[model samples]
Target: MKHFFIEELLPKAGGSVYRLTRMAARRALELSEGRPSLMRKPSSDKVTTIALEEIAEGRIVYNKEASSVSSKDSTSPRAVLMRGNLASSQEKASVS
Candidate 1:
């Protein structure tokens, strides 16, 4: 089973994203299994409910590093070199 944050669900429901009220969060937790609740106060009047699963842990990895690479003259020479090596290796393998 996958846990979803209430705020995450809002986009899926096509509703305005807002913090889930404690009442709302509690209700959702009560109805669901094995999911933890995260509460956030976004404003004086509104408290947002974010589920633990909805929050990103920290970093994200993408397989296509080329999209993230900047320009030919990027500061990270090692990364660029590695990408070029991989591309060249692929081309050579494909040609063979």
Candidate 2:
């Protein structure tokens, strides 16, 4: 399997690790499902390696429309609290 440095691929993924992983993971999923690779010569047979290669080669990119939405500070206290509350509520509802 080929290994890639985060610094090398950051720009290709719009400089966001979140976006990079999102794009790579989706592409990897497609490849694992037997979708033909877009590369003329893929770097590796492993799905993840092929996905990163595609990303580095500009075949895959972060979602432009979602940039604004995903750029939000979802790690803020309020966001975490909201998620925690939602999860607890979901658990409570499911237990009944």
Candidate 3:
């Protein structure tokens, strides 16, 4: 088994122990759900271990940006797609 110290992992996770723990937890959950690993010899690495290694190696980046999508941007691809679907549904309703 590979043993790692908290000191070694904190630097890779932007020096935040909370961030490191959060990332490792989420990644481990994904791994448990059969997500493919970013490491070699994945068969031998436990999910939590692989998660830690990925964070330590900088393979996973934290998304600091806001998650919400603004609908004010009508030209956005999501907006355009939604508009297209609405138009089609309205057309079908009129035809019926």
Candidate 4:
């Protein structure tokens, strides 16, 4: 079992704990429904734990669009990286 602090997770959900809970719940449900985990080796077999690990590790990107159904729009789920929201993956990993 891992301990997840609110401070570590708040920004991932746009600083809203409610959204965090909602997002986590939704991801957890997907895992329970047999969705494959994004993690190479999930921390646990438990669906909820796997979901949280995904979120914590930045494997899950938050869909900013208010309307969940947005295939016609942006905000695609199951994306590995959200360019606008975080540091570019291509940027050199050197601390300045």
In candidate 1, which residue pairs get closer than 3 Å at backbone N, Cα or C atoms, i.e. clash?
A: 19-48, 19-49, 20-48, 20-49
Q: Among these predicted structures, which one has the highest TM-score?
A: 4
What's the best-to-worst order under TM-score? 4, 2, 3, 1
Choose the strongest candidate by lDDT: 4
Check candidate 3 and list the clashing pairs.
Answer: none
lDDT at 39, model 4: 72
Q: Where does candidate 4 stray beyond 4 Å?
A: 65-96
Clashing pairs in 4: none
Model 1, TM vs. native? 0.18
lDDT of 3 by residue, 1-96 (tens): 777799988875567787777667777777787767766665346889887777666666553343221123334433211112446789999999
TM-score for each candidate, following the candidate numbering: 0.18, 0.62, 0.58, 0.67
Residue-level error in angstroms, candidate 3, position 19 = 1.0
Better of 2 and 3 by TM-score: 2
Ranking by lDDT: 4, 2, 3, 1
Candidate 4 residues 1-96, lDDT tens each?
877888998887788898777767777877777667777798789888887777788766575764231112234454323223234533645453
Could you list the CA RMSD of all candidates, in the order they appear?
15.8, 10.5, 13.2, 13.3
- On TM-score, the stronger of 1 and 4 is 4
lDDT, residue 37, candidate 4? 77
Q: What is the C-alpha lDDT profile of model 2 across 1-96, one tens digit per residue? A: 677889989987678897677767766776787777777788678889988887776666554544421112334322111112446789999999
lDDT of 1 by residue, 1-96 (tens): 334455544442224343223224433343254332232331122212232222222111112335231222346432121113557789999999
Candidate number with the higher lDDT (2 or 3): 2
List ranges where model 2 is wrong by over 4 Å. 66-96
